[model samples]
Target: MEAKLDLPFDADKMLAGLQRWVECESPTHDAEAVNRMMAMAGRHLALMGATVETIPGRMGFGDCVRARFPHESREKGILVLAHLDTVHPVGTLAQGLPFKRVGDKAYGPGIQDMKGGTYLAVEAIGQLIKAGIPTSKPVTVLLTSDEEVGSPSTRDLIQAEAARHSVVLVPEPARPDGGVVTGRYAIARFNLRTTGRPSHAGARLGEGRSAIREMCKQIIAIEEMTTEACTFSVGLIHGGQWVNCVATHCDAEALSMAKRQEDLDAAVERMLSLKPTGNEVHLQVTRGVTRPVWEPDDKVLALHAQAEALAKRLGFALPHESSGGGSDGNFTGAMGIPTLDGLGIQGALAHTLQEHVQISSMVPRAKLFAGLLQNV
Candidate 1:
């Protein structure tokens, strides 16, 4: 085996790499886009001297890429959680490229939301190779397809791998002040459906119980169940075949956030308990906790401490923080593993057209990650 040690990553090289990633538009739920990005990333990883494996495609164009700096044994491991899927649409890049670089800020669709974080992971590992430090633990960079939409299929894979590792690091972009996120709030998405008999407008209006009305009542009930401490939104609503006739059915999907499982269950219970009048209404709730809250557990804190020390070594401050945004780290943390987030290079206005990364953050953040991998 040949060991190469010229891992010094130049920011320019990283920039070019990022441009390639950014140029390969990947939307949150678009499977084909994700496949393209994975293919590109896989090739890059192979060139970096990693033994790469392309996880079978999930559903549509969705796929995951796993790469490891090959070692003799699977003794112990550290998993790096990253997502190649962005919030941008499939034609977003070509529609306008959105790629603008000024001074040190580079703006693009997935720049800050994630592609930047993914870039950091690659750059960091490259540094380790350059630094000539055999990885502390065999490292696996698990980049998935639909992180923005939640890892419905990949969650299991992430957790299973996380359970086997000593530490899990998530590059979920940085905080506003460029601090890495230490804690993550849990996310629960739900749907409510109501059914009522439709009747003629003026002829049998009273005979037909309005499902739409029942749905409204349920929506109000769900809304009242929320508080400042808890974030909830009944974002989608649909019903009514015709305005003249009574609505035979209604449905709404909502997003909820919680600090604990109890909080999540309580919210679900409330929605389920909602009883609609006018028509004997049926309320069905489909709830899923994509990423449960990772409230800084002791082991998690220790990991953060190591991360902070590593940042200090690189002349940067690792601001201790947590975020409401959900990531696969939450999945790892929920499984009782020490998970650390926000190791990515840049952060700001994520998931938007204004999304961008601080070009200056590239090298230092990579070094910070390398420090954690080598010394921690």
Candidate 2:
């Protein structure tokens, strides 16, 4: 006979909890705002009877919340990873993307990208506690404050904590096809700056070397370096202070992603080898935080297979694939731990104004998460 799992929380309660989180607006750069979000999550975990700790932030990032659920044994258990930070800035809610439900979609900042998944995962545990259901092992939930910015401050902490766990589950928003992530591509960030001589635009146009012009040329070159093995794009750029004067300095940020580590290494080398187009201007390239390629091994595949079975029992097909965007799973999976990712809410248009989660998917996904907690 097939077994049954009953969840104590319903869709209405889950949506209400998720709306509170989406309204908080914890952008990654704003440490105080992220801390507020962390505080909220910590309180929820505490109420669920989990031993919670708020680790102090470092390197200008916000604090991290770690909560270990009560269990009989102290043996190695499961790690549920999530991030509270988002790419959207403050006032985004008031200006646009206010939390609202329309048809089967609920739209808001960070709702689909992750806040929904994080809330549901915690709710699953909370409901399990309410139902007096015990998991196979202890569970640890780590909610970090910086991830959209590459997780620079929390990478070490992630790896260290993951080392103490048997398996890692990352709820980073389900795939567009409602699949999970088994492997992740490698990612690298670059900081580029160009320096040039400045002069009065109206009086001495020919005498000045425009840093903005040089930076534009460099950006084109960098993007043109894309190949089937790796891809590059310039996302953020800043230049020119005065309209009447030639720009003296320009700075930009670029990102490259690769399916293989060697390809990323070559791409990094090429980015650093950039040269100034003109003798009057200087170009400099600096590498930033990187996410190592996570290729699934036997252990990861086995864990994914377990989720597949659980998903099947829950009356859903759980397909998985190697994804491009990196998550904290990239860190733990690359460490050879059994890791499964994209176990979050199903939605589309992440990191955009139209970001949303399928309202109907909330209860089903929460039940799936609850099943994994008990069976995996």
Candidate 3:
């Protein structure tokens, strides 16, 4: 086997860039905060000779940044997908989610989940350019701001760009065991509302149509829909106001995931087919974010084979897996384009306070990614 490729930057510089990203705190819902993070990343990309274009945000999200490294070739190239927004709020760092290193591990709210991945891609391109490696193909890097919230504003852009590229690479954080993802489950989010008549609990309790009571029954039914291939959960729910009066309204947010698109479609249809169980109570089910399952095809499998060979050349096993969490790769891979995902730094505990990444894995993972970029 050949020796491992050397990373362009050292660990200290890598950690410094990661610290800046984690400190920015670009939560999906906070447009201004996400925009600030975008600006920071755009400046870095600009210095690497990539032309940046800002895509204005819609539906109350931050603007997206697309950086392109143009080449002379007219053939299709690689599309690098990176999300700038994370699940952490603006004050998460100040609220005890400190960006610190402990014995070769870095802990922060968004560092492990994606900021680490984004910076890894950025540094990879910088290294490629600085090393005077001639571009084999055109490279486009898309940094969207709404991935944490399901990429509502940037899904179309992702699809359109993927259609033009030969391969799409998503730099979502690698698996806990240092594996890259080859497929993802389809995710469907629903907003459910139960509306009914309210009455005085003390005076006319029997006459009241309790929406909360009705929703509780529905929630149980939904929970029962979980199977080995499909899972459902009610993440958020709110109903009653005062103890004296009967509840008139109950709102809930439920999510479902399935490994197959057909199964997910059937499950969602059944959920929407729910009828009111309580007298005078009406149920409303509106679909929220829907991400299609990314199933591996022959092209995808071939890409994975190449990735595995490349990883072996660097003296490691590149295990590919099917993930329960969905990412933008689902969009492109499901669209029939050859796509490879989880090509980012190895980490775990994403989207949690305890989220962290192995500090020692940064350089090796970046070197692997850079090698793939040159070959794929």
Model-by-model lDDT, in order? 0.78, 0.91, 0.87
lDDT of 3: 0.87
Tell me the alpha-carbon RMSD of every candidate.
Answer: 3.6, 1.2, 2.0
TM-score of each: 0.88, 0.98, 0.95
Q: For model 3, state the Cα shift of residue 62 in Å.
A: 1.4
Candidate achieving the largest lDDT: 2
- Please report how far candidate 1 places residue 328 from its true position, in Å: 0.7
Superposing every Cα of model 3 onto the true structure, what RMSD results?
2.0
lDDT of 2 by residue, 1-376 (tens): 2224556567887899999999999999999999999999999999999999999999999999999998998989999999999999999999888999999999999998799999989988888888888887899999998999899999999999999999888888998877899999999999999999999999999999999999999999889989999999999999999998999999999999999999999999999898999888999999999999999998888888888887877778889999998899899999999998999999999999999999887887788888888766
Candidate 1: segments with Cα more than 4 A from true spot: 1-7, 59-61, 94-97, 196-217, 238-249, 280-282
C-alpha positional error of residue 32 in candidate 2 after TM-score superposition, expressed in Å: 0.7
lDDT of 3 at 127: 83
What are the clashing pairs of model 1? 7-130, 31-61, 31-62, 32-61, 186-293
Per-residue accuracy of model 1 over 98-120 as CA lDDT, tens digit each:
78788888988798878887887
Model 3: CA > 4 A from native: 1-4, 201-207, 240-244
User: What TM-score quantifies how close candidate 2 is to the native fold?
Assistant: 0.98
Of the two candidates 2 and 3, the one with more favorable TM-score, higher being better, is: 2
